[model samples]
Target: MSRTTLTLGPLLYNWPAADWRDFYARIADEAPVDTVCIGEVVCSKRQPFYADVIPETIERLERAGKTVILSTLALPTLDRELKYCGSLAREASQMIEVNDISTIPALAKRPHAIGPLINVYNEAAAAFLIAGGAARIALPPELPLKSISAIVAAARNAVIEVWAFGRIPLAISARCYHARLHGRTKDSCQFVCEQDLDGLDVETLDGERFLAVNGVQTLSYSYCNLIFEARQLESLGVSALRLSPHTCDMVAVSQIFRDVLDGIREPSHAMRAMRTICSDAAFSNGFVHGTNGALYVLE
Candidate 1:
């Protein structure tokens, strides 16, 4: 059986610089992933805090036999943000994963990656991206398995990736929800998003867990768990599983997925272990099954 490649997606939360460095360092030395995406994928304002540690993290991951890729911001609005994406596209030594389409022209002729944020819902979109020099494409998490299969079949040559774990990113906004909740505006806010490493929970009127709020990104309350579908995903032509980073033990999470893919552990056992690691979180496989994004569907 062929081994499915595992990838560490760029961290989406505003974690401390030291924590970010340590997390990547541990992943580089311990995780069994094939590729590690590093850089700021959320707000560019948070980039300066951890920009210095990225180079060292890249060096460590590369030295450990991991392909390191730089990720562009998911929503590039400001002039500086556009410039940052341009810089990433210009980096010759590393492959860049563009979360925003505005970074495409800058990466023209250069081999680049299309992040999950890009709306690649059809074969035409996938073909366009592949023709535009996309070497790899991480499909959006909300896509159903049939859509994924079709996209995978259409994107024959490029490496196809799926969101295997972590909170599903739902939307990106111009205003900061975290700041608004804390009674601050997008500009005047003092980085209140840093308070929630796993994202601030957004509950419903009845106090039920509903969504999560980052600076501007809105995420699903339940974590998307695909441990049980690893084999089926590989059978459908998915080459890699992109694991979004959270505050949990990501190395263990990667290991569990690796074990399941290798046929060394049952999905049930792995799911149980994962629940233990992520005690407060609920699991969801609904989007993959063509249902609601928050419900867990057992097949």
Candidate 2:
């Protein structure tokens, strides 16, 4: 099987600015990822807290021989948010990942990659992005195997990546659930989301854990695990596996995927190792298999 490169996706939670800085500093020195995406893709309010550290982090990662990509906000609503997206589009240090259509016009002529948050479910969307100067694309997590194969076929010459790890980001809303749960509006959110590093878990009325709320983004309850399907992904011509960051042992996680891709370890062994590091959340690969998003099938 051909080796699939690993990519460390941007941090999704609103961690302390110092914690955020330390995370990337460690990743630059230790993680085995080919690319590291840096920027705020969630709430725009969180950007100001760690905005100054972005340049240094990117420089540090670049110096360490890691490719850096700037990710745009997944859902831009305010005028300030649009301006921030434009600024990111005009950036010259690294390539930008378009997470929302609002960013497309600003990034029209520039070379950029489409992030998973943007809906690229069919051939038409994939072709449109490629025509608009998309050099690479990370397909949405909800896309099934058939759709993935079709999109890959549609963009045969362009680089294709998938959200192969972490909790699948399901949706983005204008209202902050964290604020809503606290009886506060988005403007008066009071930075409540920073309390949960992994996000606040939501459960169904039956007491079944269902999803998680992080500011305005909603994530799947189960961590998307594809350790057992690494070879299958490579067979489908997938070029990269995007591993979203969490407050866990990411260096070891990256090494596990690296060893599996390098043929030094088996999928079963990698699965066991992952369980040891992952927080007590269920694992699922059902969305990729064309079923409910939370089911996992072991081959």
lDDT of each: 0.92, 0.89
TM-score of each: 0.98, 0.97
Clashes of 2: 0
Please give the lDDT score for candidate 1: 0.92
Residues 94-118 of candidate 1: C-alpha lDDT, one tens digit per residue: 9999999899999866888999999
Model 1, TM vs. native? 0.98
Tens-digit lDDT track for model 2 on 20-44? 9999999999999999998889999
The reply for model 2, stretches above 4 Å from the true place, is none
In angstroms, give how far residue 40 of model 1 lies from its true place: 0.7
Best candidate according to TM-score: 1
Clash pairs for candidate 2? none
Clash count, one per candidate:
0, 0
| Model 1 segments more than 4 A misplaced | none
